[model samples]
Target: MSSPQASPAASVRADVWLWAARFFKTRSLAKQAIDGGKVQLNDASCKPAKAVSVGDRLRIGRGEERLEVEVLGLSEQRGPAPQAQALYRESEASLAAREAAKAQRKLVGAMAPPMRPDKHARRELRRLKDSM
Candidate 1:
């Protein structure tokens, strides 16, 4: 009988982990962003070569979107979306913040009507009637 294969420990390079977990497209891109000081580990900025282990928290920034996640596991190879999702656990605050931002955006979106000028603003009715 063959013995079951043992799984490897959950650990990966910070950049590779980020890329494999879908935080960035390519490992080099992830490294560049991390080296440029765009990524944080447990709230403090970290280097690209830093090792990431399970339970480590990361704060990643992509444009206006900021995501906070805790490393639940690690994978060196880039995999499918479902497998990638197994790597990290997103923070509750991050989810709430995103939802709040969405709601605020909807409220602001409702402020402006489709047309630039309303009927009331189209003409000064009193002036028009007086001229007539």
Candidate 2:
């Protein structure tokens, strides 16, 4: 009988791929994202255990950053960054869009509100909330 370690195949679980690719820090985080519909296979959201193979497409949304990648290979074990990166290829358009979004964020950084409101500002915010 084949052991569990001998079960590697041409395809791999969606969550494991994400973790190995360094997209998520842990398998749990990747699984959580899958459950929350933040990860999609071939343009449709899929379960964490869904088998992902080479040539398959994926859409992943992290915070405000969205990514589209094409699977190039599969690995049953997690590896170093360079090796993990070999498993997928990001589309040029997706890379460009991410870059543009990053640029926009940098340009608008100075316009964002302070981290925390001052005591007077907080009082004003409370007054505004009370009126509603």
Candidate 3:
């Protein structure tokens, strides 16, 4: 019989692991991300059924955020946030990069114009376009 510590060394499906880790809300979303090449195993693209074991590296791209983590534990069941977080250890470099990206996005958003222009602004834009 295997010991409790040995369970972390066991392999689980890539999608299952992602879901269990709380990377995605559901297994289907994890599978979709894997299929779309948004997830990588060991620096290479992997399928949903790929075996994920402890110590394996994973790069997951979700929306504008990219995370690089190393598997530290394994669980097939989805649990609380703390438990899920225990599944992987994100790299310090990845955390810094994400924070920088977020700050850049915030700066850019602040500089962007409003969604809709006023009537006067629209008229001025139209006049400018007609002159071109």
Candidate 4:
């Protein structure tokens, strides 16, 4: 007989940890990301069942956003957002890169034309095409 707090899990499956950490909505999604090479452990691609423990680094790519985080704790259960967030600590460099990318995206979005062209604008475009 021993105290419950005296021992904790030494490792968990990569996919399970990702889902538990809230990086992906579901374990299957995490598995897919791992298979697709969108997730890397310690700078190397790993299988979904790869073991993840504390202090290990993880790089996860989702859409245009990439995250690099250090594992702080281990959990196999999906919990509240706050609890999930506590499972990993993102590096400062990763945070800065994400912010810079977000700013760049905003600038690009500002330069894009509106969703719909006005009647006059459409006619001008048609006139240019007909002249060509």
Candidate 5:
């Protein structure tokens, strides 16, 4: 007879949730963030292995994006964006803040030049660095 199938998790670790929700690309990165205070649970610092349940609030920060979300569903496996979005609900204030930050960044940042510097420019930079 086939062995009994293992049941799915009702609550998952904080690191796993972050990766599954697409906040961090890898579980290790999620764990690092958890350790470094970039991620919080219910307004308090929590460990990477902390169990997160539905209705619990989370604060996640990555680069320019800062998210305050409430967990709505649980899944251990990562999924597509549409499916992942089902896992949490972002607050209206958080959405507004994110949009405002995006707009401000666009207004303040400059665009890149057409291409990389030529060989002469690279050589000049090398000479300057060596002289220093």
Candidate 6:
């Protein structure tokens, strides 16, 4: 018997693609952003159901950073970080901005002590609390 015909190329929803690509930590987070109109497709805002295919451009916002990327592949299953990265090509500007943010965070982290109060600070806090 002849093999069944292969199904035509099918695209996944933008939110699903983003989640599968590991762009967002959770599918709901992606959906929330999509519903809130924070994500853009080809420079135009699109809903969560907007289909995504290879070569499509996407602008995603997470926290204080924005990622500008071009889809390079398609997958609906979430995978490792390295594999997820293969699904999209980030722009140079995005990479640079991420690196800069990383560097800034590192510098700030180095300049400050751990957030936990030190013993001396704890004693001072006790004295102040007693006074109050």
Per-model lDDT = 0.81, 0.88, 0.91, 0.91, 0.86, 0.84
lDDT of 5 by residue, 1-132 (tens): 321111166688899888888888999999999999999899999999999888899999888799999998786778788877888999999999999999888866656454687999999989999999
RMSD of 3: 5.1
Q: Give per-residue CA lDDT, model 4, range 1-132, as digits (tens).
A: 532212278899999999989999999999999999999999998999999989999999999999999998888788789888888999999999999999999999999988898899999999999999
- Sort by TM-score, best first: 4, 3, 2, 5, 6, 1
**Candidate 5 similarity to native, TM-score:** 0.77
Candidate 6's displacement at residue 58, Å, is 0.8
For model 4, the superposed segments whose C-alpha errors exceed 4 Å read 1-7, 118-132
Across 1-132, the per-residue lDDT of candidate 3 in tens digits comes to: 532223644699999999989999999999999999999999998999999989999999999999999998888888779888887999999999999999999999999988898899999999999999
RMSD in angstroms, all models?
Answer: 5.9, 7.0, 5.1, 4.5, 6.7, 5.4
TM-score, per-candidate, Cα-based: 0.73, 0.78, 0.82, 0.84, 0.77, 0.74
Select the stronger candidate by lDDT from 1 and 5: 5
Better of 3 and 5 by TM-score: 3
Clashes of each: 0, 0, 0, 0, 0, 0
Worst 10 residues of 1 by lDDT: 1-10
lDDT by residue for model 1 over 44-75, one digit each (tens)?
Answer: 88998788888899999887677899988777
| Local error of candidate 1 at residue 51 (angstroms) | 0.3
Candidate 1 — which residues are off by over 4 angstroms?
1-10, 109-132
Alpha carbon lDDT of residue 26, candidate 4? 95
Off by over 4 Å in 5: 1-8, 110-132
Candidate 3 vs. true structure, TM-score: 0.82
Which stretches in model 2 have alpha-carbon errors above 4 Å?
Answer: 1-8, 113-132
